[model samples]
Target: MLQLQVPCSWYFWALAFGFNLAMHNLKNILISVVIVSNLGKIIRTCTCLYKQDSTEHHDHIE
Candidate 1:
């Protein structure tokens, strides 16, 4: 009985550890994705603004 109980307890602990690790990794991945998406949007916005500004500046040159 003791040996069987020990293996059961170990299995339960192993499951719990794996679950915790997976949750942590998932959270990190989500956070990184959000940050990357926001950065891309910001870069795109900046480039658009720069192009508009340059075009308007050229129109005024003549």
Candidate 2:
């Protein structure tokens, strides 16, 4: 019984370890995606504001 149990326990531990590693990697990927999307949004907004400002400046000169 003891001999049988040891191998089973080891298999269970290995499965759990693999699962934990996969979840950790998935979390990091999700975080990076969110950060990149937010950065893109911020850049777009800044570009729009800059364009508007330049247009207004040109209007004033005219």
Query: How does model 2 score by TM-score?
Result: 0.60
Worst 10 residues of 2 by lDDT: 20-29
lDDT of 2 at 9: 96
lDDT of 2: 0.95
| lDDT per residue (tens digit) for residues 1-62 in model 2 | 99999999999999999888878799888999999999999999999999999999999999
Model 1 alpha-carbon miss at residue 28, Å:
2.1
Candidate 2: misplaced stretches above 4 Å? Answer: 1-22
TM-score of each: 0.60, 0.60
Across 1-62, the per-residue lDDT of candidate 1 in tens digits comes to: 99999999999999999999879799888999999999999999999999999999999996
